[model samples]
Target: MTVLATPHPTGHPGYSETLPREPESAAVARRLVRTALAAWGLEEHIDDAMVVITELVSNAVEYGRLASIRVVVTRPAKHRVRLGVVDRSRTVPMMRTDSNGDRIRGRGLVLVDSLTERWGTDLHQWGKQVWGELKCEPPR
Candidate 1:
C-alpha cells in the first residue's frame, strides 16, 4: 500500500492510501481515517468516519474493477471532514429499498446517510468517487 499525507489546495491536511481491493483493506482504510482525524484533532468524527470509510471500501472491493482502490480523507473546511473512496468502476451506488420503504441490502449506505451531513458520488471519466462529509464545531 502507498500512503500519502499532504496539504490540500485548500490548505488543509489531506491523507490518502492506495490499497488492494480486498475485504481486509477496510481495516487499513479505517486506520487511515483514524490517523488523519486524530492529526487534525477531529477525534469526534472518527467513529462515524470509520463506519463511512468501511462501507465505501467494502462496496468498492465488492463491485469495483481494477486491482486497487484509493481511500481519501480531507478537511475541506475547518470543521468539516470529507471521506472518500475512489474505484475504477463507473457504476454508481444506489440505496436499496423494498416496497415497504424499508432498507434492503444496501443498509450500509443508509447508515452512511444517517451519520453524514451529506453524501454523494462524483463521477469521473476514469472512475467514480463516493464521499461523505462530517461536520462539527472546531474545538475551542
Candidate 2:
C-alpha cells in the first residue's frame, strides 16, 4: 500500500493511498480519511467523508476487479472536502433508484446523493474515477 501525505502548495493539504482489491481495504480507506481530516483540522467532516469513501472503495473492490484501488481525500477550499476513488474498471456507476425501500443492496449512490453537496464520475482511458464533495463547516 503506497500512501501519499504530501503538503499541497495551496496549503489545504492532500492525502492518497492505494489499497488492494480486498474487503479489508474499505476499512483502511476510512482510517486514512480520518487521519487526513484530523491533520487538516477538519474532523467535523469525518463521518460524512468516511461514508462516501467507504461506498466508493467498496464499489471499486467489488466491481473493479483490479489489483489495487486508489483513494484520495483533499480539501480544495476552506469549506469543502472531496473524496475520490480510482479503479481499473471502466464501468461507470449508476444511481439505482428502484431500491423498493427494503432492499439490502443498491442504495450506495442514493445515500451519496442525499449526503454529498455534489458527486459524479469521470471516465478515462485507463478506468474511471468517482468523486463526492462535502460542503462542511469547521468545528466550533
Candidate 3:
C-alpha cells in the first residue's frame, strides 16, 4: 500500500524519498540527514535525529509491510526540523517497558521521547507517519 502524496506544507521546505525497507538504507538516510543538518547549522541534533530515524525505519522494515515507506524531512525554519517516516501499518507504536521497568529492547521510543521536545505518529486515510520535532537549543 505504498502511496504518492504531497508532503506537509511547511515554511522552510521539505523533501520526500521512498527508501527500501532495509538496514542499509537507514545508514544512507542518516548520512543524508547529517549533511542536511550540517548545512542548516543544526548538526548538533543530527546524530540523535538519525538514530531515531534509523530506529523508525528499521521498525517499519521489520514489522510494517505490504506498503512502501516514505521519509519526509521538513526544515520548517532555523532552530527546528521535522522528520516523518510513514508506513502502511496501523499498529500504533509505543514506548513499552518490561516487568522490572528495565527496557532492554524497546528503548527505541524511550530514546526518541527523551531526545526531542515532542514526537508522534501520523495515521490517516493515507498511512502511518512516525514523526519527531528537533529543537535547536544550544548546549548548556
Candidate 4:
C-alpha cells in the first residue's frame, strides 16, 4: 500500500492511502482519519469522522471495482474536515429512506447523513469518490 501525508497549498494537512479493497481496510481508513484529526487538533470531530470513513470505506469495499481503494482525509478549512473514499466503481451511494431498526443493512448512509454536515459523491470517468464533511471549531 502507498501512503501520502502532506500539507496542501492552503497549509492544511491532508492524508491518503491506497489499500486493498477488503473489509479489513476500514480499520486502516479509520486510523488515517483519527491521525489527521489529531494532528489538526480537531479531535472533537474524530468520532463522527470515524463513522463516516468506515461507512464510506465499507461501501467501496463491498461494491467498488478494481483491486484497491483510496482513503482520504483532508482539512479543507480551519473549521472543517473532509473524509473520502475513492473506488473504481461508478456506483453512487444512496440513503435508504425505508430503513428501520430491524434491518441490519442499508443504514450506513443514513448514519453518515446524520453525522456529517454534508456528504456527496464526485463522479469521474474511472470511478467515484464518496465524501463527508464534519464541522468543528478550531482548537484554541
Q: Over the stretch 8-43, how does candidate 2's per-residue lDDT look in tens digits?
A: 422323888888888799899999989878876778
lDDT by residue (tens digit), candidate 3, 31-135 = 666755665556678878898788777777776766457777777755678877778888888876555365456667777787777899878875688887888
Candidate 2 at 38: error in angstroms? 0.7
**Index of the highest-lDDT prediction:** 4
Off by over 4 Å in 2: 8-13, 100-102
User: Model 4 — TM-score against the truth?
Assistant: 0.92
Q: Please give the clash total of every predicted structure, in order.
A: 0, 0, 0, 0
**Model 1 per-residue lDDT at 62:** 88
Model 1 TM-score (2 dp): 0.89
User: Which residue ranges in model 3 land beyond 4 Å of their true spot?
Assistant: 1-13, 99-103, 137-140
Order candidates by TM-score, high to low.
Answer: 4, 2, 1, 3
Model 3 per-residue lDDT at 124? 83
lDDT of each candidate versus the true structure: 0.85, 0.83, 0.71, 0.86
Off by over 4 Å in 1: 7-13, 99-104
Q: Specify the poorest-scoring 10-residue window by lDDT in model 3.
A: 1-10
Best by TM-score: 4
Q: What is the lDDT of residue 85 in candidate 1?
A: 95
For model 4, state the Cα shift of residue 87 in Å.
0.3
